[model samples]
Target: MGIVGYFLPMLICAAIPVQSLSRNAETALCQTQEMQGLCALSGKWRNQLQSEITITCKKGTIQGLYDSTVGNGAYDLVGKYLQVNETDYIVGWSVAYKNQHRDARSTASWTGVFYAAEDIIKTQWIRAAFKNPEDYWSTFTTNQDTFSRVQSHPCLHNNRN
Candidate 1:
């Protein structure tokens, strides 16, 4: 191919700043995660622990409700839906159990991803128990869970259980 032909693509990319490219990518991600579309990452999901969470994704934010059978009850959740690059979409969220005083804070936090191919969210988390104001040691436990969508993705309508 001619040199102009080879450099045309490069020239086109160079015309757009790197920051602009990043913003465009984020916008595209939001489009896919919009509420109206059923492509992925917006639904009711349940884990093996019988914990159910209803997730909603939009504009790089994740908002939902989580209910744990073993915990007090249901709670509101807020998190991020991040696209670090072309191949990575990371999900992180927090459910705070208590917050009455400076040292009286308890929470469970999670970080994971939604696998588009299998439509499952595999995550690792830490559940931290509140400690006394002057305590040096804190009590916490770690665990992992795989969350499956309550309803199948549209593309896998009749193919998945």
Candidate 2:
């Protein structure tokens, strides 16, 4: 009976859900308007200067950067795009951090979508270009290279070079 008592607690724990409960909470939390945009991007992102970017979708302002400093930053879902004030050093584009070899590589651009009510802005660059091949290409390549590269792939595959 004493052994059964110890096993009973273990059995009860096994019966109760811990992972599921956490997942349910996470899903519910992420579904919130502020977090909705970041549901796919809530992670540790690092920049070339080894700057750490922690994106959380809670009740707070998601600040944008100018010269790596928050400047003229706005988190609003205005119209179809999430408009953040253009940063001096950032060139009005969001940089996606790629974690590789214990170092994060800053990608050319990221797709931004802001939620005003939630005071959250989400940015990510999963693929090369979201739209407008020419526009996305120029962000990463110079005029000469952009023209040449567009000639071959024409899809901006190697535009990141």
Candidate 3:
């Protein structure tokens, strides 16, 4: 006779369908092969250098800007997004900017995959400094970087270091 007793049964029955619809809709819009789900990557990301990147995705193309806290300033980035194995979110992009901190001209390119579970992008990048062509050995350097999504509002359990 209580409302809780009556509504519990109805709520339980409704839960399955609501969950199914949500799952189905996510699959339809988030498929990587169709480039529909790149929107998931749209947001602000912070790199280890404290550099910030704001990215937007449409179709298979990515348009974004990289703001270097340590470098010159802000630079436009061009890149492509792909869905591999229909489950993995893959991305590659390049940016050319002057590194005022290093007093050098350089172009850096990154190839990485977005980890949805962790909301992070791990990348390996090769930065080439423009200098004497013969100084090729010292011109290029490689390193791995992790970019974490910058939350607009911190989570209750946000423990990012």
lDDT of 1 at 89: 68
Clashing residue pairs in candidate 2 (N, C-alpha, C atoms within 3 angstroms): none
In candidate 1, residue 74 scores what lDDT? 64
User: Considering every candidate listed, which one attains the maximal lDDT?
Assistant: 3
Which parts of model 1 are misplaced by more than 4 Å?
1-39, 84-88, 98-105, 133-136, 152-161
Estimate TM-scores for all models. Answer: 0.62, 0.23, 0.64
**What range of 10 consecutive residues in model 1 has the weakest lDDT sum?**
152-161
lDDT of 1 at 3: 42
Which candidate should be chosen as best, given TM-score against the real structure?
A: 3
Better of 1 and 3 by lDDT: 3
Residue-level lDDT of model 1, residues 42-151, one tens digit each, is 55789998898776554576666677877666666668877655544688899886423233356888999877667688999988887676763657888998998774
Candidate 3 lDDT score at position 153: 16
- Cα RMSD of all models vs. native, in order, equals 14.2, 19.9, 15.6
Per-model tally of clashing residue pairs: 0, 0, 0
Model 2 TM-score is: 0.23
Model 2 lDDT on a 0 to 1 scale: 0.29
If both were scored by lDDT, which would come out higher, candidate 1 or candidate 2?
1
- Sorted by lDDT (best first), the order is 3, 1, 2
